[model samples]
Target chain A: MSRTRVHNFTISLDGFATGEGLSAEQPFGHAGHRLHQWMMATAFGAPIMGLPGGSSGVDNAFAQQHEPGIGAEIMGSRKFGPPGWQDDPNWRGWWGPNPPFHTPTYVLTSRPRSPLEMEGGTTFHFLDAPGAEALKIAQEAASGKDVRIGGGPTMLRDFLAAGLIDHLHVVQVPVLLGRGVRLWDGLEGLEQQYQVETVSTPSGVTHFTFSR
Target chain B: MSRTRVHNFTISLDGFATGEGLSAEQPFGHAGHRLHQWMMATAFGAPIMGLPGGSSGVDNAFAQQHEPGIGAEIMGSRKFGPPGWQDDPNWRGWWGPNPPFHTPTYVLTSRPRSPLEMEGGTTFHFLDAPGAEALKIAQEAASGKDVRIGGGPTMLRDFLAAGLIDHLHVVQVPVLLGRGVRLWDGLEGLEQQYQVETVSTPSGVTHFTFSR
Candidate 1:
């Protein structure tokens, strides 16, 4: 049974997955790395800082969960690229040549593009499927492992509202974005379906995991 | 210098301070005691259950902060009573003859009413002042001790946005209210102003404290 999961998805106190006006220059917009700075200080996120070792505490333990047994990832177009990456034919994702997602990554976009094969067993497949349809494709591509729902809040909220996520892990950063897309908007009473657990690390980030 | 603070304010994982359509019958609306159940299990909150001994853990320690430094309490009308409470002249408050608040309590409402003197020194004074002006009156009522800014999300958010709160303690309950009044709205960049702390207890509630 292929499961769908969301891991290490950092959100502000106000529930913004990423700050407003995301772009190539600032993928996180006004938020910058505030939502992810805590993770960047973790062992799994040390790569972002060009460091060898990061904290191995509970924060790192949760951050490291991003990779194990994940065969494919489905992400929204907003996450695949900035506002208008489709306009630039030469645009090759924010992550350089060797991206972090070393799996068959399906990018959900209104305008689908041709598959872009990169190093490290990662191939970008653009799809225009809705939540359930997209999950079906990603589940098939996962091939019995698991499919990760990489997000912008809107996409994550869509999947969550559609009841497609089997496991959801949200890291609540202390910062309040005030504005931006909200992940919990349509997810009212969504906690009833899943068994939720919460842990607070010394860094002040609370890790929330929901398993159905 | 009397500082204003917020303590033992419990909110859901989705940031709803209280569930929607709050009324006299359903005080916390659809949320009921779900958000504050963890506190109800604590030593300080045990009295609300007509009990003596309760868990003497971190939650009790945090809940105990509600009384020590406070003299008078200032709260929005929403916290004072249900909607359209002004129409009912017979309505003293939601609490019984001897309310939980044993000090001079100021209720912010557009329609100011004559003070209601209840048992146990709890006096409900309806004021039409805005956040700052209302705080000034509450501070004077405190005489020297700190004034507690009791909340219903809208009132607390106003005080928070106005930068009038010296300390903010929010208890994050594991439950999720799909729709309701949010506590963190318009509070962007609030973390930078405070030295924030987090602690998760066995009761599965995480307490977030922001001290300036």
Candidate 2:
């Protein structure tokens, strides 16, 4: 079964996945990297920071679940780049030559561009489609493997609201981001659809996994 | 020293403390009793429902912490009664004759009325005061004991935003209310002052305690 999963999508206590004033220089805006500090301290996330070692605690255990059966990723346009990435002709991505998503990564945007293949099997395929439509394209590209909903909040909220997510993992950080793009907006009765499990690590971040 | 604290205050995943269309019949509005269901199942909360026994687990431990060190309570007008409660002269609060407060409970409202003394120690004092002024009055009434900030979300947000709270215990309910009175508005960078601790119980609700 081709499942659609969202792993390690971090949000503030107020449910803001990213923060206000997000720009090219400040990816997460006022939030900075506060939302992802827990992940950075984890063993799975440490390698991304070029660190030799990190905590192998519960955080690392959850962080390592990001790339298991994930063959294709569908991310929001904001997640692909900053505000005006479409205007810039040379905007490949934030991840330099070789991006982290080692799959056929689909970027949902109104203004579509040609597929830019990166190193390590990662390719940026810009698609001018809705969430469901984008998911279908990603699913086909995923082949036998599952599709990953790479988020920036708005995209994930739309997918969850539309009942397209199969497995969703959310990390709740303690900080309160006053204003930002919220993840739980319009998701009123979302719990009724999934079996939710939660665990709080020593680092003070609570991990919530909603599985259908 | 009288410390101001908020305890067992539950909010939905999207930061809604209470749902939309709140009325006298539905005290917590569309939220119903979903937010406090975890507390209701605890030994401390079970007694309120006339239950002989309940779970004495981590939820119970946190629920029991509500009363011990409190002498006075200050709640928002919305928490005391329904929206048009001030108009009705016969309104003596929803918590009947012998209310659970058992202390001088201050209700912040623009339309002040005479104090209604109940059967028990609980007395409803209507005051037209802001968060700080109300806290001062509550502190005096509390004497040496700690003063509890009884919330309905909007009131708590005000106290929190004003930086008048010394301790705050927020229960993150799994359900998302979607539309309602939010608790985390204007509370950015709140983690800086408080030492936060998170524990997710088997009841599927996460307890977050922020203490200075």
Candidate 1 lDDT, A16-42, residue by residue in tens: 888888888999999998989898898
Relative to the unseen true structure, what is the C-alpha lDDT of residue A164 in candidate 2, on a scale of 0 to 100?
99
RMSD of each: 1.4, 1.2
Q: What lDDT tens digits, residue by residue, belong to model 1 across residues B106-134?
A: 99999998999999989999999899998
Candidate 1 CAPRI grade? high
Candidate 2: regions farther than 4 A off: none
| Worst 10 contiguous positions by lDDT, candidate 1 chain B | B45-54
Position A65, candidate 2: lDDT: 89
Residue-level lDDT for A76 in candidate 1:
93
- Residue pairs with backbone atoms closer than 3 Å in model 1 (clashes): A188-B178
- Point out the worst 10-residue segment of candidate 2 chain B by lDDT: B45-54
